[model samples]
Target: MALNSGNGTVPDSKLGDEHVAVQKLQPDAKIYDRLMTLSGFFKQQYGDEPEFYVRVPGRVNIIGEHVDYCGYSVLPMAVEQSIILAVGTNKQRAQLELHHLDEGKFQSFDCDLSDLEIKLPKTGGPGWYSYFLCGIKGIQEELNDKWRPIGMRIALSGNVPLAAGLSSSSALVSAAVLATGHAQGMPLDRKQLASISASCEQYIGTHSGGMDQAIAYLAKQGCAQHIEFHPKLKGTPVTLPAGSCFVVANSLVQKRKAASSDYNERVVECRLATRWLAKSQKLPNWKDLIRFVDLQEACHLDNDAYVKLIDQQLKKSIYTREDICEGLGITEQELETDFLTPSTQHMQQFKLRQRALHVIQEAGRVVKFRQICEQLQRRSSKQDIEQLGQLMQESHHSLRELYECSHPDLERLVALSAKQGVSARVTGAGWGGCIVAMCDSVKAASDYVNVLKREYYAQLPAHLLERYQPNDFNEVVFATFPSNGAELFVQ
Candidate 1:
C-alpha cells in the first residue's frame, strides 16, 4: 500500500532506444486503493506477495472506427480507467494461475506453461482469462521455441467496463504481454508489444484492427493519439482543442463481439468492396488489393477520388455469391475461401456499398479530426472545435446508417446527447457498447453528466437498477481525461 515500497523497473531491452518506462509509483489515492485491494487478493490466492504490477489503460476512440484493418489512421485517447495486474513468478512446476478480483463474474483458470491454449465457447466469446492467454501465446510464438516463458501467478483488477466500446479486453491482453515479456526479460518496445497484442486477439476470434492495442501502449498523458497502421505502427500525439472534454456513457447493453460474426462480416465486406472496385476499374492487381487505402494509392486517387470511385462502382444493395463470382472471375468455392472468414462463411448477401462507404468516409473524418485538433493547438477557436464536433456527428451517422453497427441503445444515448447540444458517437466495434460525447468545457461535461443520470441511467432495467448507488456513479457515465499507457510497478 505504501507508495515507496521499492524500486520498479522497465524490462531489459537491447534492441530499442525506448521501451515502456518504469518508474516509482506516484501518490494517487484512487490508484493506490485499486492496487492495494489487488495486492491483498494476490496474497490471499497465491500465498505470496507480488513481484510487480502491470497497468494498461483502456481507450475511447475519438473518431474513426472499423477502418484500421483497411490500413487507415484512427484518433483515440487513453482513459484513466485501466486493467491492473499484480504479477509474481511461479517457479513451482511451471504453472500459470489467474485470479480475478470479481470472483462471482470471472472464475479462476490455471494450466501448465507448456500447455497454454485458449478454449473459446461454442456460442459466446471465451472468458476474461482467454485474452490473457492470447497475449502470452503471442510472445511465445514470437520466440518460436527458442525460449520458454517462466511460470506466473496473476491477480487482475479492472475498472474498464466490460463489453463496452472501451478497449477493456485489449488492455488486458496488452498487460499480459507486458507482464510475460518483461518477466522473461524480452526486449520488446511499446510498438512491438502493440503489434503483437493486436495480432494475437485473432486467437479469440475477433479481428481487431490494431487501434485499440496501439493506443494501449503508445498513449501519452495529456493528448489524443493519431494512430497510423498503413505505413507502419506509429502514434503521433495530437493536442485536444482547448476547453474540450470527452465524456463516456455506457448504454448497459453488452454484446461479446466474438459471440457473433458482425465484426468480422464488416471486415469481409470491405475486402469484397475493395476487390470489386479494383476489378471494375480494370486494375491489373485487383485480386491482391483488399484494403481501400492501398487501392487509393494504386489508382493514384486521393481520399475524395477513391470515395467517388466507390460511389460509382459499388452500387449494390446485396451482391450475391454468383454476382460477385462472375464479376471477379472466381468460383463460389474460391470466393468463400478467399474473401470470407470462418465465422462469416454463412453469408449470402453482402452490403458492399454501405460498409465500404462508412470506412472510406470515416477514415477521412479521422484525418479532418486530427487536422482540426492541430489547428486548435496553434490557435484556440470555438469554431474549429465545433467543426470537430460536426465531424464526430457525421462519423456516428455513418456508423449507424452505412456501417449498421449502431444499436438502438446507442441511438437513444445519441438522441439524448443531441437534446443536450452535444456531439456523440459509438466508440468501439459498436454492435452494443458505450457512446462517447464531446463537451466544450468541464462545466458543460458536468451538466451533461447530471442530465444523463436523471434521464438515462436512472431508468435502467431492474437488474442494474438495484445495484445503483448515487455516489458511485462513475461506472455508468464519466468525464475521462487522457492518461499514460502501460507501465510496470515493482516492489
Candidate 2:
C-alpha cells in the first residue's frame, strides 16, 4: 500500500514534471495506485505482471466544427485533459485482457487480428470504450501479413467527458494504438497511426472525417492546427494574435443520442448533396470537385440543407429563372441540360444553404485569419486582435444562422460573451456543447465567469456544475500553423 512502490522501485513522489507543474504534483501516485489496484486484480485472476502504461489527450474544436467530413478546413487544439492507460502485456496466448478505472471490471478477449469481425454480446457496451477496441481492429487490418503476436492488460483514467463532442474516445484509441505499436516494436509513422485510428473510429459506425486522429497523432505543446483534409492530409499552424488566449468552457450537457440525430443526419444530407453536385458539375463524382460544398452549390441546391433540416419553403426557394440564367450565365434551354434533371435528383435536402456558405467562406477565412494573426505578430498591434474577435463573432453568427449548430445554451453563452464585449462562439459540432470565448480583458473574463456561475450553471442539477472557471484575462495561445500528428512517447 506504500505510494510509489510498484515493481520494487520507489519513484520520487516530487520528481515528475506533472507534479511540479500542477502544484500538488505526484507522478508516482497515479502510477502506484493504478499498479497496486491492477496488480491485485490480475493476481486474483491471471497471476501475472502487467506491462507499460499509456496516455493521450482529448481535443476541442476551436473553430470549424462539423466541416471536417465536408472536405473543408478545421481548427482544433488538443486539450490538457487526457486518457491515461496502463497495459499489462501477456503474450502467452492469443488473448487480450482489459480493465477500466471507474468500472473496476475486467474483460478478456481472444487476440484474433485476422478475422477483424466483432462478436458483441450487446451492440453498445458501457461508454466509448468499445470504439477504442474498434481502433485496434483497424490497426490489425493495416498489418496484413505482418500482424504481431500480443495480449494486453489496460487500466484507464482521464477527465475528458464522454459524449461531449470532444475527441475523448479517439484519444483513448490513439493511446492504445501507440502503446500496442510500441510494445510490439512495430514501425508505424504518425500518418499511419492516424489513418489506422481513423479507420477504426469508422468501424464504430460514426464515419468521422479524420481530423481528430490527425490532430491526436500530430499535436505538440502550445499551438493549434489548421488541417486540410482530402486527397492528401496536410496541416498548417494557426497563428493566433499575440496576447490572446484559447479559453474553452464545457457546457456539461451531453448531447442525447436520440435528440442528436440532427448531427449525423446532416452528414448524410451533405453526402447526397455531393452526389447532386457531381452530376451538376459535369464531373464523374463529387469527389472529383476537391470541395464538397462547392459541388453542392453548383447543383443549385441551398447549402444549409447539409448542416440542418431545410424547410419546404427553403427547398422551393430559389433564384428566379432569369436570375438562374444570369447567375450561371445560361439560358433556360441550356439550363435544362446544365441545371435540371442531371441523372442525380430526388435527393433528401437538409436546410443547409446558409450552413454550406458559411463552411465554404469560413474555410477561406481560416487562411486570412492566419495571415492576420501573423501580421499582428510582426507588428504587435491590438487592432488585429479586435479584428480577430470580430471574425470569431462572425463565425459564430454564421454557425448559428447558417450552420445551425448553435443551441440555446450556446446562444446564452454567446450573449454573455457579447455583454462582456468579448468574442465567443459555439466551439464544437454545436447543437449542444461548450463555447470558446476570447476575453477582451482579464477582468472581463473573470467577471463573466462570475455571472455564469451566479446565474446559469449554479442552479443546475447537483451533479452538473462548472468543470473549471475562466480567469479575468485571456491567455494568449500561439496557434501557429500545422504541426505533427498523434505520436508515441517512449523512454
- Name the top lDDT candidate: 1
Q: Stretches of candidate 1 above 4 Å error?
A: 1-17, 26-30, 470-472
Per-residue CA lDDT of model 1 for 321-352, tens digit only, reads 89889889999999989888999989998999
> CA shift at 325, candidate 1, in angstroms?
1.1
Score candidate 1 by lDDT: 0.87
For all candidates, what are the clash counts?
A: 0, 36
Reference-based lDDT, residue 133, model 2: 67
Return the top candidate by TM-score: 1
Estimated TM-score for each candidate: 0.95, 0.73
Local distance difference test values of all predictions, in order: 0.87, 0.58
Task: Write one digit per residue (lDDT tens) for candidate 2, span 171-195.
Answer: 8778777766765666656667777
In model 1, pairs of residues that clash are none
